[model samples]
Target: MIPTNRLSSSRNSRKPVCSRAVSRRGLIVAGLMLGLLGAGSAGAYGLCPGEMENAGRMQQRILREWPLRSSSDPASRFIQQLGVFLAQYGDEGIPWRFSLVRNLAPNAFSIGAGNVFVTEGAITFAQSESELAAIIAHELGHELAGHFCADSYSRGEGDIFMPPSEHYEVGVGSIRQSIDPAKEQQADRIAVSLLQAAGYDPHAMLQVARRLPAGGEVHLHDPRRIHSLERLLAGYPPAGGLPDSLTFKEVRRVIMGETHQR
Candidate 1:
């Protein structure tokens, strides 16, 4: 009888202990979530759990399938240099990579592991160096903030910044949809900051926004986004900075076929 009573007392004592443990765990999880929200607001990019482990492997696999334009090409080199300059402000110790794709669609995307890619059409579409930098900066922002990694898990695939084969009715009709509204805004904000830090006019982003064709190969027209960009640019009025250089002009001339060189 005494042993039975002792057993009951022991079980009762453990009940409060178990409850306390669960409560502590819940508080810890809540704290972590709050911290993540705070970081997001501060423009600090945080990867999802276990993302760092798989990002490299996934990036390598995707690069194999994606046709990469040769880095030795003059046009490709020009884009790469611009992307590298913008990427310098990203996370340290990360090996930043840039590639210019051969596709003519005005699209740019970033996979994980600091790998950023721009289509030839994007370069041809930009009116100025700042405009092109704006596009690259936006993709860099996506990579820095780990949006691509999060998107990959959500969609259960390697490439999250592109649409599926079925969605392709014509040339890159669905590529723009890969970036949802919230992520796009977040990336834009980050890109603007990066551009400003790199001595590029933030207003150049607005110019590109205005230039993008409505329902075109690149991003479709979003009035809300345009309004937001306008507001952001208003904060940074245009001042003289890095405008189109001779090198940039040469690259554009070659890309547009305005000059033919053997």
Candidate 2:
């Protein structure tokens, strides 16, 4: 596990009322899931008891607080399919669940235990399916690397629940847990490998990085991170990967339509 101290401490301390409400709901949902699901063994991930319990709670909280696009929605299905496809190339310890969030921020995050989420903003922001795949692949990298468990353990609090005032900014930013630069680079490397293995244009990772705002609390888009990706991709041939599909275009259109209707 990556050391918890390596995780960045930089975060905005503003908590909106809605965020607090979500925390309360999360606590309630955590209790219900604990009763229904039981605190199973940590299994191969070697998660601590608290980490295992909190993972289920976090998943439930996200589902309850966010308005996920219906599974029947084309955009929702597309993201789920792409995420599952990429996950096949990584760890298989937990069942993966991918869903599109209805929020307008171009964000993606993983809550460990194979749960990944991408927002409608991300679907529209991505120019091609490969770019969106790059995002999902990156989140998979975090999960596969066990960053979540590491961060939770580092807190020494034995709980995966973040402070109520800590809010992960929307858009390509950190999760509720602040991932440090080294871990970010590690995830980026894993993302490129996953993309290559899954037949996505690995350079699409660079393309997405280049388009994001650089240098801020959003370290995910820092120029240093982009350069690291560039170095990582230098050896791979750029052109032979999969092309954008009609389905991707259709999903984008559907998501955009939904966004406009709101």
Candidate 3:
């Protein structure tokens, strides 16, 4: 990546401002979370990190074999680049990485650490930079919140909706496997804060949410992209010109490829 720039400003106040009036569950660093996570969690949640790393490596190879409609997919590249901004440079830990997978389902998901995957359908479905990033940030919240680590124990208690199911690292610190409606809501709240903290517009995050297939029932065979979107904002689309809320510099920088170092 080109010389990295700060996510908040040129301008990374890695020490998150406690007075930002963060939402109840905003994804803020209590203090250098990523650094601390890297240091500890060696014995407990360590397996989660290993699982994430393995998933990332596997997806990278899968993308290598994906058949793209064309060689140039700026939006796809944008997703990858933005991911580097949020996961690598950001203070929040549990490193995230991005990849595009060939699928018709308009969806995306992050498993393990920073392992986020966007289906071809999703890329084709998104109209602008914000929709794609909204999906990505939501998934990132799951990874950061340690949602994947639940697979191991959840298998005995109930069904888990994850792939490479049996590979859940046992050594990882135990994260709650509650699939309760409340937890889903909590994850969504975190996504909103994460996107905002990363300088992506939260309203756009809602756009991705409204476009999702909605109803009282959730599909079993279908992926959870929209469900995840709904969780992020409880089915409300970001109103007004969310673009107006973006930091002028961050928006210009991302649009101009000033931060496409990845």
Candidate 1 residue 75 Cα shift, in angstroms, is 2.3
- Higher-TM-score candidate among 1 and 3? 1
lDDT string, candidate 2, 39-133, tens digits: 21111232223445556776666766788889898778888888877765553344678988888877788776677889888888788888999
- Which residue pairs in candidate 3 have backbone atoms (N, alpha carbon, C) closer than 3 angstroms, thus clashing? 44-172, 44-173, 45-173, 96-114, 97-114
Error of 3 at 193 (Å): 0.7
* Residue-by-residue lDDT tens digits, candidate 1, 1-262: 0111110112222222124223322322342345431121222123444455556655566466667778898878888788777765543323567888766668777655567778877888888888899999887766655564543443444333454453322234222235465556666776776677567877777777777777655455566678888877777766546878798888877777832331
lDDT for each residue of candidate 3 in 13-116, tens digit (9 for 90 to 100): 22222212131122244312443321212111122424544454445544565543332455456567766654432233345557655455576655464567
Candidate 3, poorest ten consecutive residues by summed lDDT: 37-46
lDDT value, residue 237 of candidate 1:
61
Model 1, global lDDT: 0.60
Clashing residue pairs for model 2 = none
TM-score of each: 0.68, 0.71, 0.52
Looking at candidate 2, the ten consecutive residues that score lowest on lDDT are 36-45
Per-model CA lDDT versus the true structure: 0.60, 0.64, 0.45
In candidate 1, the residue pairs with backbone N, CA or C atoms under 3 Å apart (3 or more residues apart, or in different chains) clash, namely none
What is the Å distance of residue 258 in model 3 from its true position?
Answer: 26
- Give candidate 3's error at residue 131 in angstroms: 2.1
> What does candidate 3 score in Cα RMSD to the true structure?
11.3
